[model samples]
Target: MVKNHSSLLQNKEFQYFIIATTILDLGKKLSWVALSWFVYQITGSALSVGIVISASTISPLIASIIAGGILDSYNRKNIIVIENIIRGLILSLIPILFWIDALDLWSIVVVVSINGMLSSFTNIGSRTILPSLVNKNQLESANAIVSMTSQFGYLIGPSIGGFSVALFGEPMTLFFNVLCFFIAAFLYSLIPTESYQSQNHQKTNVLSTDNRMRKFFFDTKEGMTFLLKFKPVLFIAFITFFFNLTYSPFETMLPIYVKDILLTGPESLGFMWTAFAIGAFLGSLLWVKIKRTFIYSYALGLIIILWGITPTFFVYFSNIYMIYTLMFIGGIVYAPYNIISPTIQQILIPNDKRGRVLGVIGLIGGLGFPIGVYFSGMLAEFLGASTIILGSGVLTILLGICVIIHPSLRFSQMTNLDNIKENL
Candidate 1:
């Protein structure tokens, strides 16, 4: 059956899904920026920032498995709508809690952790369902559009979040985030039933069983088996995992690094992150152009190295303008990896197993943060943020070299979509 994707985009339900999701993402980013700043302000410590981030990410990292199972089982549209409402309600309280001085450090951690779990589940469902809405041929373009919106949100969200915190405070930012979620939830309710209904019945016959746990494990096994046979996917997963281990520290510890080493404030941190996001935005927009000029794998490795090392040098230089420029450049290189990694998964992995395989990727790649944050925070406490960043830079550059040396990784299952379709 040939689906009319343009018509689908014009469909009220699809529009709701896209717009609502975009708004939800904006709020999520805003809250995250606010949370980071709030923690840093109160504790006056970099380690505290790392700790809050680690706590928030921990649940999502753990929930990826179960979240995948749920995503595969549930009516995804309903799952997303319900999750957004719940997310909004929970986040709305932060401001009230803060107003009364009732919000403690532990309370923030607990709330953010719960938020992460729900957010992860919603993401799993939303991403799993997107391809079902559009024609197969549109997958790359669709993914690019989604990535573009993400970059746009990142581009604006941090700046707004930063300035909002300066003018309004953490609670007000949290309140604004709650508003975005409400809007998202409302918009999600309008998606057409036809686009989502067919898959439900189709999957039911295969997935319906007496023992869900047994089926869950079986599903997980299938996804793992698929990855085992596909050399490119496996290598990319490992590369993403290690690269994340090096780069995750920047997000977790970068603000703290700016504050502690550079003796800057929230506005400074905001500009720095905005720079990173802008760079990412530029990189994502250049996806088509870069695909022509560079080998995606090798180029991605080099980007990771540049991203890691540039900030190290910029921090040493201590000019905020230079730091922003370098961060922007780093982000430019960093964007393609995000696009390429997920596109590869969608292109290679079977549709039925996407939830679990993506979960596996999330599980493996996500572990980098808690690990990075824990160690980086500990190191920053004793040695300093600069030394830790320099070490990360050296590690990323070495990892890139190692990847280049291995031919299996360097040239594994080269991604040519036309050939992939032909084989299928």
Candidate 2:
């Protein structure tokens, strides 16, 4: 059990992972702003940007199974090293293509799709390796630290990116992001396999059979079966599907909202995202104390309710300051959900099954993103972005209310309390 969160860095590999994650996240945000604006410029339609973003999201629906199986079968360190290196290589092509005037909307979509596919491996591997890296009591703190750095990136990266875009142009700004990915890959490469190797926890590999296609199906089935067996995870998955579906469109429409409704430039957009991260950063800081000392069930529910209601207020305001305020509050509500979720999963599942089970969860959650974005784009083309945002807020609230009514989900909120009591 980790008595001090500060002591977490004493483990050298965890230290490397944290540093790598922070560097990558910071660069990723810078690159993301460039990419989104670039998409908007190419097709001159909000719908086109959504289509391009959705192209990446679509692969998680299919590649997740393959990713999970590979993580379980292969060395995870190699997965981290290889995945980021490839993504860095793939993403580097964009700036090169654009420089030669060879970049097109379809080409952008293809690269993003491939990068998203690779992300499943890196993401699942990261989660799967955490339990091996820290004690049970340290999971929340570890995840909280990670969440804080990621939020910090979102907070600061955009402001820098916006100015960079104004100065260096989007393609040049993206090259910095490619470097960030490479930096992360190098950090992962530095992690000694002897020091932080994952213990093979499962006695039998799910894909022991020789029939390749059949192995895929059976492995997927095994993951699904494990997910169903755990009621809390299954329930969370069910509730999140609705919120994520609505949220996907909400996110897809945000850049357009900044331009048309908020009446702002990329600078204001940067501040709005910065506002969110500040709120989320505050929330996560509180979470560290709350998880250590108090009843967290109520905190979880309050966060969910706030998530649903915030957007309703969001659409009524046109002033950028007011929108920034709303974004900050939304970020405050958002942090706990992201930080605590994996901590709960880590505490619940055994070490071996983490990859496969999380893959299934990703598959389930990821399904809503592309489908929602595509349709939302079509509707935004007709009804306008404000209308879509309002409708999404209402639906998100409805899902929150449903989770409140569901007994199992309500019990699931007591999870932190139960863990604390067990420790006592």
> Which regions of candidate 1 deviate over 4 angstroms?
1-17, 193-214, 290-294, 408-424
Clashes of each: 1, 0
Model 1 has a clash total of 1
- Note the residue pairs that clash in candidate 1: 13-191
Worst-scoring 10-residue span by lDDT in model 1: 193-202
lDDT tens digits by residue: candidate 2, 1-424: 2355777868787888888888777787887788878888678798898888788788766788778766765577778788998898898888899989999999898888898899788777777777777776677788988888778788898887878887888888888888888889899888776433434413233335565456555666787788887776766666556667877777788888988887776777778778988999898888777634433344455667787787788678898888889989999888988876677767776655677788888788778878888889889999988888887888777666666666654433434535533543
The Cα local distance difference test for each model comes to 0.72, 0.76
Pairs that collide in candidate 2 are none
Q: Estimate each model's TM-score.
A: 0.89, 0.90
How high is the lDDT of residue 123 in model 2? 74
Reference-based lDDT, residue 119, model 2? 77
